[model samples]
Target: MQVIDLLHTATRELAEAGVDGGDLDGQLLLGACLNKSRTELFLAADMEVPEEARRVFLRYLERRKRREPIAYILGEREFWSLPFIVNPSVLIPRPETEFLVEQVLAACRPRRGLHDGWILDLCCGSGAIAVVLALELQRDIVAVDISCDALAVAQQNCRRHKVDDRVALVKADLLTAFAAERRFSLLVSNPPYVSRRQLRQGLDPEVAGYEPLLALDGGEDGLDIIARIKEMLPVIMRPGGEVFIEIGAEQGPALLRMFAPSAGAAELVKTVEILKDYAGRDRVLHLLLSGYGR
Candidate 1:
């Protein structure tokens, strides 16, 4: 059959299976099977697809119909204008996390006396945010993760971005690796913030079943990891250092109250601020250390 006809059939099959981006997925698979770009497929719509290519295309379509994410199939995803290798070992980098990176970039930009600054990306899956910092600022990065396998993927990605030299991958349980003498100019993370109850209810099959559970489950209230990081804030961040974290939509006010203590505790102020995505949901938190006096 002509490639165009096959593409149409695949799209219909995918749509029937309830895939949200069925047509686009079908076209991408078709392009992959032919070892051609998606744009190339559009230009060659009328060309006859070889028999082998057609069979492979059908196989990929079958996998998609089962609801496997396209990123897993492709084994790579684009983030921060760069390509990153992704697998079941790591959580897929989402668009929402870009805002966290933006906040960190703003915080880490060069100042007159600040040189050789440091940034810590806690739970640095695939090293996306940390690597970006290294590439942009030419600064040192300590990318930490609990899972060695996930760190391996991050190592590969760091090498691919050519910023591996600037990053130090450490295996530790949240701020444990940092000595009292060490401190970061900026700390960023997109830690596992999904509650255990959410997982019990089932997440996307690709996420709940395939993605690392250690990277997703946030215990009872989804604040397990966040709380640990918060406790470490006073020790790890230098004066005037900041943290940018990605949180679930519903946890905004709770984060604010947690960070900003009053009366018995030091009065927390706007320095621990929240930012919303275009969806108007609180997705990123930018916590400044300026207001806290030593």
Candidate 2:
């Protein structure tokens, strides 16, 4: 069968199995199997695929038919205009997290000593935010994650973006693993905030079965990690520091209340702002902090 006809047939089959962008997915799978670009695939539609190539592509199609994410199957995903290596060990970086990164970039601007100013990217899955900030802002950064496998992917991405020299990668849960002396002017994260109830809501197979549970399950109420970060804010941040976090859409007010305190080690000076994703859901939390109330 010709490649174009095969793609049409595959797309119909995939769509029946609930896959969107069926034709694109089919083309990508075939191209990967043949080590050809999509344009090449288009040009060679009439060329016969060898038996070996056909078999390899069939295997990938089988996985895609099961609703496995194409990114995981491809072992890479692009975030913030940069390609990142991804696997089940890490959560797929989402466009929503980009808003948090933007907030940090804006806040971190106009501040002196940026070269020496430290930025900590907590739960640095795929190191998307950390690498982008380091490369774009030329700031020193430390990216922390609990899973070593996830950190490995993050490291590769850092290298790909050529920010390895500016960013330090650490394996730790939140900020707990950092030395006490380590303090940052900016702290950012896209921690797991999906509640158990949300998970029970039956996620897509691409998300539920294949993606790592460690990167999705957010404990009973989904604020477990966020709370921990709040408690450690005092020790981990310098004076007049800022934090940018991505929360579940419904979590903005709750998080603001939890982190809000008047006479504490890390007083919430003001809620700088909350930003919504393209879907119009509140997804980012920005907090301005002053150390131990001056």
Candidate 3:
């Protein structure tokens, strides 16, 4: 069949299967199968698809029909304007997570950033944040995760981006695995925040069935990991250090309460701000840690 005919038929099939953005997905898959750019495909819409290309195109259609993510199918996702490798082992990088990177860059703009330049990237899936930060700043990033499979994917990404020299991948849950006497100048994370209740209700099949649940489950209330990270801050962060975290919208007020000037942590946490994304959802928590008055 001609490119245009194949595209039309594929689009219809995907849409009928309840796939969102069927038209765009169809074009992308078809372009991949034909080894042509989307623009190139359009330019030669009347040309016949090669027999081998047609077979690959059919396989691509079957995968999409089963609700696998396009990024996983393509084996890449764009973040910070750079393409990074992705797979079922790691959660797919989303645009909202980029907001966390922006906040971190803004916080470190004036200084040399990571003094002695030691930085910690917790729950560093795909090492997307680490790769972006490595390129954007001169720092030593120790990225940690509990899953070896996820770490493998992240390490590949670091190598692909030529940041392998600077990013250290660790297999640990948060910071407990690190015994080095190190203090980070800045700490950044995009930890899992989806609650058990949220998952029970069902996510899109692309997410619910295909993506790794280890990267999605944030425990019962969704605050379990966030709260744990807060407790570990004083031990890991340098005086006057900053933390930028991606958070669920509904958790803003709760985070405020958790960070409120309390008998134990009031003096340790200097300032807290709930920043919103373009969608007006409360998305990130910016914390200024200056220590408990020396």
Candidate 4:
């Protein structure tokens, strides 16, 4: 069939299967099958698809129809304007997480010699944040994740971005493997924050069915991992260090309370504030450790 006709069929199939952005997904998949850019496909809409390419496009279409994420199908996703490999083993990097990177860069850019100690990327899925930080800061980083499979994917990304030598991958649950020596000067994470209730209610089929659960389930209150990170802050973070954590939109207040100055909390915390995403909803929790105080 002609490129245009095949694209129409794929789009209709995807849309009927309840896929969002079906037309765009069709274009991307079809273009991939033909080994052509979307623009090239559009320009050559009248050209007939080769038999082999048509079969591959149909297979890709079926996968999309089953709610598999395009990134998983394509095996890559762009974050911080750099392409990173992704799979079911690791969560696909989202655009909003770029804001977390921006906040970290902004926080460290003004201070000379801020990269003195190690930068820890906790729960570093696919090493997207670590790769970006290593490139942007020219600093050494330790990217940690609990899943060995995720770490494997992260290692590929680090090598792909040519930051393998700079960004070390560690398999550990949070900071459990690290010594309590306050080694990290800066920390960033996009831990699982989707509440159990939220998951039970439902997420898009692409997310609920395909993405790694270890990277999505934030536990009963969605703060299980976040809280654990909070508890380890005193041991892992240097006095003047800062932590940037990506959070759910409605999680800002709860995080604030969790880190608030109370009997057991906020002793090591100097400042705890939530940064809003583009939509003005809480998306990142920026915490400053007390002592040398930046």
- Taking the candidates one at a time, how many backbone clashes does each contain? 0, 1, 1, 0
- Superposed model 1: Cα runs more than 4 Å off: 110-116, 263-270, 290-293
Q: Which 10 residues in a row give candidate 3 its minimum summed lDDT?
A: 109-118
Model 1 scores a TM of 0.92
Better of 2 and 4 by TM-score: 4
**lDDT order of candidates, best first?**
4, 3, 1, 2
Model 4 is weakest, by summed lDDT over 10 consecutive residues, at 260-269
Q: Score every model by TM-score.
A: 0.92, 0.91, 0.96, 0.97
The TM-score between candidate 4 and the true structure equals: 0.97
For model 2, which pairs clash? 265-292
Error of 1 at 212 (Å): 1.7
Q: What digit string (tens of lDDT, one per residue) describes model 3 on residues 1-294? A: 899998998889999999988889989998988789899999999999998988888888889999999899989898999999999999999989998898888778766544554788899989999999988986678899999999999999999999999999999989897554547768899998988999999888999999999888898878788889888877777778888889998889988888888636687689888999999999998888865578
Candidate with the larger lDDT of 2 and 3: 3
| lDDT for residue 182 in candidate 2, whole number 0-100 | 35
Error of 1 at 130 (Å): 1.5
Return the top candidate by lDDT.
4
Expressed as tens digits, the lDDT of each residue in 106-196 for candidate 4 is 9999976466778999999999999999999999999999999999999998888899999989999999999989888888999999999
In terms of lDDT, model 4 sits at 0.90
Q: Over the stretch 1-294, how does candidate 2's per-residue lDDT look in tens digits?
A: 667776877798899999899999999888877888899999998988888878777788888999988888888887888888998888887777777787778767776643344788988988989989988787788899999998999888888888998889998878878666636878888898899998988888889989888888888889898888877877767767777889898987777667655434235454455677778888887777754556
Candidate 4 clash figure, as a count: 0
Model 4 RMSD, rounded to 1 decimal: 1.6
